[model samples]
Target: MGKGAILGSAALALVSAARSARTVATWRTVRPLPEAPLDKGKVSVVIPVRDEESTIDGCLASLRTQRHSDLEIVVVDDASTDRTVEIVRQHVAEDPRVRLVRTDGPPPGWAGKVHAMYRGVAETSGEWLLFVDSDTESAPDLVGKLVAAAARDDADLITTPGRATVPNSGWWLLLAPTNVLLFDTASPDGSRGKAVGIGHCILVSRAAYDRTGGWRALSGEHADDVAFATAVRDAGGRTRLVDGMDSITSSGLDSFGAVWRSQRKSMVAGGAMVGGPAAGAAALGLGGLLHIAYGVAPVLMSLRGNGFVRLAGLAAWAAQAAAHRTYMVASHQSGATAVLAPVANATFGAQMLDAAWRSVRGGNLWKGRDIR
Candidate 1:
């Protein structure tokens, strides 16, 4: 390698080490999802569903077990052609707290999930609204604990990272590294300018939601969570973003094509699902190059080099791998994944670039609907 290239790789290796340490230090400050009791008023859980037959049953089963006494579960059906609605209907009959709402479709300029949320709000009254994704299995104390934490923080909205896992090993290799992105974006400050959102589970107060026109205001976007957080923060409402850890888990992607489409749907404009193609592409390109330098170069160099280069590369490689592994372990995936940090980093970076392309190139699709 040229002197400049070697120097650049060394520089990036140091960068990776710093970030890795920062990742560890960052989590030390994050409080886990509380297991506290729910003293809060009536809490409504709204789960938006489409063709989710494969997972809806398990999701509802988990909700049925929530220990919160004064909770109502509303499963909104967004014109699913599958048995998703049938399954939710069974839950409605089985549990008094569980109710089913149906929407014909999103009106002229709204996203499916956003519209379903609006319908859910109209059907029942609750001081708190907990939006749960159809694929997550929550702990028994999800509602109460989350509410307790939100109340303590005086937050208008709170979102937490799920214990995200991939059922397929092949999918794991490409997607696990992206887990680092999920935890980092939500914010160390989750208050105003720094407040980003997580899509898995968000607990929001009905007052703040209504005051900010929450769901209705986010009617046109699939990446509604961040926009929702932004709306709340802009309105002088507080948001507390934290790690949910074991309190929740999400089966993020099952199919190969899903990894591609889902990443693109999320990569654009930080969840607004659209952005300047050039800007998106540029960011992706630069990030990819840096990953190759810090995340992949050391691994390859360590295996084949002179005495000095080999030892230096070995040290650098260890730092980069350790960082990636820390992220994998924190997200509840196996640390064994860090063994392939080089490959995983390269794959994830390339995937992000592909997502940037598809996102800006008008190819983003989620749940059979175009997001961009």
Candidate 2:
């Protein structure tokens, strides 16, 4: 090989090594909080429900069996047209711990979920606030573990990655990996110096919530969890991510169309918050293209019989996949999926492009609302 080729390879290797070191540092710095056995402080579980009739029953049923006896359940019905309210009311009637609150509309500049969450928090009296989704089913000890984790780590906020129950469809196998990839890239467990948190199952101390100005502070933010965590961290509060896969399962996302629409809406909404539609779209487009190019280069190099180029490409791809798989398995994904990690990474890259283009054209829609 020429000296110029060797120098280029050496530079690439150095960059790769630096990225790996950063990922390792992230994992070591942010360890999972230890599990709490029971709710030591008064705990309130808040669930914001919309048209979740299909899964609300199972979610409430699971909550009813929670081992945290001292906890209260607050369900905010966000003007659903389905039987979601009825199901929640039934659960409320059966157990005094569960209360139902109704909201007619989201206030200006506030997303529906954040508006509902504010109402739920206002109606509950607990030292700890747990914001859970209506489409999620929790294990009996889920609340206890979250509370325990919070206390053990002195975390101001705690979030978990739940199992994504994708429907049995080819689209799901192809696109579902984007969610995992996002978590891997943005989460502290996967990358260093990256702010990370998921909204599905977030636990915040009442003090921390109040100090950060609660949901009202994040009222205008589309990615409320990320905004809230950033606020906490900026205020010198600690946040931790926990493994909630076995403790909670999500309703199966059954349609490819639904996944694409949902993701597009989310990207647009989040993008809008960071920048206007134009800048956000451009950022997503550029990032997506780079990711896809990197992912496909290895295959192209190998096919061309360029051993040096192929080796470099393969190493880069493997490093990226390994980092992603580490985050997935740590979050409780099955090892079987790890074997398909490269495929997942590539799919994620493709989805980013689709989402960005859809967002720019104002094609993003969700829950009967056009986020863009």
Candidate 3:
């Protein structure tokens, strides 16, 4: 390799090593799920659905068996064209704790799921409220455990991370870079300027939620979870992201197209919400560049370069893979996915660029709604 090539590879190697170190450290601080059995509070689990027939039943099946005896499950339907409502009706007849709530749909200026969530909250009277996506499933003790963690930590709102299970190994490999990247950087508490939230499993106290203005405040928001968490923090309430990987899972976004749309929507909407067009665009660009450089560059150099260039590339790739193992294990993903980082990074970088383009050019839709 030329001197220039060797110098560039060595520089990249150092950058990846540094980034990997920081990523590993941040993820290491994420508190694990509480193991000790604890007291259960009166909790209401609200599931807001539009057209989720394929996954709602599995979600309910997971909730109904909750060890938290003092619990009520409310499945709010927002005019699902499919059998989502009918499926919930069957569960309602069987489980006394489960109730079905119907809503006409969101009024002007309100997002669909946000409107349903608002309506669902009105029908319940629990000290704690859990807003779960219809595609997500929780372990029996999930509610009890989160409630306990919240109480012990004085947190008013808690978000448990659950990346929907990717069905195709190849698709998952494509997604691995972004997943590990996010898992490494997301704040475990709402200490950042705006908290990034996991929509599928949000646990919040009714008191704090009401004080923060609840879903009503986020009626028009496409990024409702992040908006809600930000509201909680703005109101002086504590919002935390806890480790619920072992207890929560979701069967969502099964196809590559679904994955692409989901990522784009969040990137476009989340960036706009946080920093408007310019800052968000800049952030996405920088992040995409980093992911590509860290994940893809080294692998290429390792594969094609000679001598020191190849060695530096190999070292960087090894460092990133080792750092990524911590997150993979925490999220229950196969650690072997780390080897696919190059493909994953390229996929993530492309998605981010897509988001940036859509942001400036306008028009990204979700369920007939223009999110960006």
Local accuracy of candidate 3 as per-residue lDDT tens digits, 135-201: 8888888888898889778899888777557654534544555545554545567665566577878
Which candidate number maximizes TM-score?
A: 2
TM-scores for all candidates: the values are 0.85, 0.87, 0.85
Poorly placed runs, candidate 2 (over 4 Å): 1-36, 165-194, 252-261, 336-340
The alpha-carbon lDDT assigned to residue 218 of candidate 1 equals 78
Candidate 1 is scored at a TM of 0.85
Instruction: Tell me the tens digit of each residue's lDDT in model 1 across 1-372.
Output: 578656755675676576666556655656666666566689898998989998899889999998888889999999999999999989889999999988888999888888998898887788999988898888888888898888777788888866755544434556555655544444544531446667779888888888887687878767688778878887778887777867887765655666665666676544334355566666776666655555667776778765656666777667656766776666666777666766766777776667656655655366766565
Clashes per candidate (backbone, < 3 Å): 0, 1, 0
- 2 or 3: which has the higher lDDT? 3
Task: Tell me each candidate's RMSD, in Å, in order.
Answer: 3.2, 3.4, 3.2
What Cα-based lDDT does every candidate model obtain? Answer: 0.73, 0.70, 0.78
* Cα-based lDDT at residue 95, candidate 2: 93
Candidate 3 overall Cα lDDT vs. reference? 0.78
Candidate 2 structure, TM-score to reference: 0.87
